[model samples]
Target: MVNDDPRVSPEARTRVKDAIDALGYRPNIAARSLLLGRTRTIGLLTVGSTAYGPASLTLATERAVSNTGYGFRLANTVDVDIDSVENGLSLLLDQGVDAVIVNEPTSTFRHRRHGLAIPVLSLSEPLDLSDVELVVGSDEAGGVKEAVEHLLGLGHATVHHIAGPQEWPSSKRRREAWKAALEAAGRDVPDSIEGDWSAASGYEAGLEFAKRPEVTAVFAANDHMAIGLMRSLQRAGRRVPEDISIVGFDDVPEAAFLSRALTTVHQDLAVAAVRGVELLMEVLDGGREGGTIERVPTRLVVRETTQAPVASS
Candidate 1:
């Protein structure tokens, strides 16, 4: 009644507004929710930095979510499996989140959700969840393909791969892309080495690579493994780019600053994050439904770690 009522004097309205401003009056969220029927909050469920890819995506999503004028609640798990994902979702629902964003969705995500209490968006790799919206991660496949192709272009006969854990969707994408790239070039897809996305696993793979004098090029799934591989190579007396060339995925903070400066796939974490939150918000507003995945782009960054293999005379 105080708003635009003919009988209400402008001076009185101004006085009340000034007084409220002076008092720094703020609305109670609970009371506001009762009126608007929306909590204006988001729930983030993620494994969160257990690996390079998920960690980067989570940090980016958090910043984007905050900038969008909505509060966010997060449920993080140490072990990313079906049960852990379900537990995080239920917790967010219990707390009355307006929507959920699955930041670290696993390859097994389709088997995890029985249903969602609110709109759900996933910062995902490829998935078969037809009813759920996916803010697909940047073109990991294309980026990895470039990494592989770069090695082939440098005249490597075949390239070895030290891949991340097979259960993760990103790991699978990178691995499959590597295989396809090799096959497309009519090069052999050498036996792949599996890493747990750890430096130790990469170091172990490095040991194996050092034993193969003919292995002239290699790609590791992420930077940690790549760094480890480099260390192992140095220790084994195999010079980088001279004896073997290496490529890594996920251009993390220190990629360019390392001793050998890693060549890697550059994905904009902030872009992925912003898109995920925006998609979740759109879903909360009933703006869009599922059956589609939006992909952000990715590219390859070349640095000191890679070069043309030493040509045999």
Candidate 2:
């Protein structure tokens, strides 16, 4: 009856249902899983509590999970070190999750699942983990490549970069792509400024840029840093797109309305999250092999922050 066997008498099913309805009984999902050997639940581990990418991806995963008729649990962490990740997953597993999703693992993240018995998926930068079933994220390298190319097409002499922490896979990919784009075009590869994906760090880099009049174009790894860089430039009396052109990744909500609208790379965070969960489902279905990475696409978003460099009279 629990299996809903078609051979079971329909009247018998109705009687059991009526009895349960009369008693107002509800099946305990966890207990039911114990009996059936499948929980149909997924655990999610998000990177930062307030970071834009992780936050948006979290919502996407939740929506996707709901669509799949599965329950979920979430854990948020600021630290992405291997030990911290292990602890986070341990907590989720204690909740009896049948599967797990690591929302945004840093590049420096080391994989050690402590002999995890269930399938593992990640919505972070694609790190080919031998033990993981699926890894997925936006094509950060492609996005940055496009962003840099766009700025170069605008007649800028060179496009500088403000990158996220070096430890992060996304930041590293973007940084490498930016460098590769510059080299491919025979443009000088300038040293990149490092940021913590925070406006404060970008502002710090901006403070330095304000002193260098040679900087005409810049690409920031994320939108928050872009906002910081722009605001800093404004304070230094440098006008965006007029005195300095800028491009950022991750088209955050307010990017369009910023004082001088932001030009950015639009990463479909929600789509990536949905894809990760879908991949997880495929893995759980037992036909797909592990180590597959699905790359979600990203596009360039032109806005007021980018333009052709002003010609010197």
Best model per TM-score:
1
Q: On a 0 to 1 TM-score scale, where does candidate 1 land against the true structure?
A: 0.88
CA RMSD per model (angstroms): 3.5, 3.1
Candidate 1 lDDT (Cα, 0 to 1): 0.81
TM-score, one value per model: 0.88, 0.87
Q: Please identify model 1 stretches exceeding 4 Å from their true place.
A: 1-27, 48-50, 109-114, 126-132
Per-residue lDDT tens digits of candidate 1, residues 173-274? 889999999999998899999998998999999999999889899999999999999999999999997898999988988899988888998988778777
Query: In candidate 2, residue 134 scores what lDDT?
Result: 80
Candidate 2 whole-model C-alpha lDDT, 0 to 1: 0.84
TM-score of 2: 0.87
Cα distance off (Å), candidate 2, residue 139: 1.1
Candidate 2 least-lDDT 10 residues: 106-115
